[model samples]
Target: MENNKQPQLINPAELFNPEPYGFSHSISVKSPFQMCFISGQSGGEGENHVLTDDFKMQVQNALKNLKIVLQSHSMTFENIVKITLLIVDHNQEKLEIWVAEAKKVWKGTFLPTSTLIPVSQLALPGMLFEIDAIAVK
Candidate 1:
């Protein structure tokens, strides 16, 4: 017989700039399973994929878009083990707000290892945020 239980989620509080520093807190999954690599999703829907040019709105829309992707694969944010966030202008104050909003969606349980990168610009001019994720089921 073999144990088929899911690996315990790893959390590193002081993983040396664990988040917002391009570092991962943990790698929980092993090979040999179906993997989903979601592309960097920006705020908006088809033909209306233009971000609002506002950080908060862009962040909201981006997260909504991510949800759609997750649903398409029959998975939710809980299944996500890793996430990468890209921001056009990274500000600490704005980040605080973003974190608050994230908590609402993530529920502070089963937090996925994440990274946030501050870039000068995204794929679009007005885009303020983009999120990409990887998950296994």
Candidate 2:
């Protein structure tokens, strides 16, 4: 059975609204909840970890992978409390793309707390984006 207790998504008025950026300021999860810490996922697919050169495709696939992971744990994006995003060569264009893709994934739902870090490179070649999340159940 799904738990009745729900996490509290916070966005204090004092702080700039972060929803447009596809995240909340913070999340307060109460007791008696199970937490799942998902590993960073990239656009790599299948056991071979094949990836494409397209940034949009990479972001889309990464989100798909994350959704699959969440489903495996009997959870959804709504269960996510915190998400960390890593982007290589982050820029205005990339940021716009990320926001647009994120909105598509988290559409009509409360977004999770998030932090995005721009790095020079990632662990693997052709990896432009990576996302990790913490979910509460």
Candidate 3:
């Protein structure tokens, strides 16, 4: 795909640079590209959909699941323009883990815009983290 069709990550001078946190302030996408909206993915696995209790594992698994969906469309993390993260019992430690996992997925300068929402619970028990993404190509 052409570079112009990719999402443009922007962190304005007036706004705080969110790169240290593993995201951008905003993203701009051009036309002549297809858009993909993925549903929230959690740490659950297998036919029974069992979720792991470990917070870091959950975060990793969630990102892995997101990647599975992206690959189904022949896209990668670089194609993602935005993501929404849900963390159960959010805290500094959990945030750090999430950022670390996100950095592993998005290694380049173009990080996706993200919104993190902390909640008491998720769709499934033992689910500690979830992530949904929007991608363009």
List clashing residue pairs in candidate 2.
Answer: none
On residues 9-73, what C-alpha lDDT tens digit does candidate 1 reach at each position?
Answer: 33223112224535442333445664566667677545435456578887787777777666665
Q: Can you list the residue pairs that collide in candidate 3?
A: none
Worst 10 residues of 1 by lDDT: 9-18
| Position 38, candidate 1: lDDT | 69
- The residue ranges of model 3 lying beyond 4 angstroms of the native Cα positions read 1-31
- lDDT sort, best first: 2, 3, 1
Q: After superposition, how far is residue 130 of candidate 3 from its true place, in Å?
A: 0.6
Q: Arrange candidates by TM-score, highest first: which order?
A: 3, 2, 1
Error of 2 at 71 (Å): 0.4
Candidate 3, lDDT over the whole model = 0.76
TM-score of each: 0.73, 0.76, 0.76
Stretches off by above 4 angstroms in model 1 are 1-32
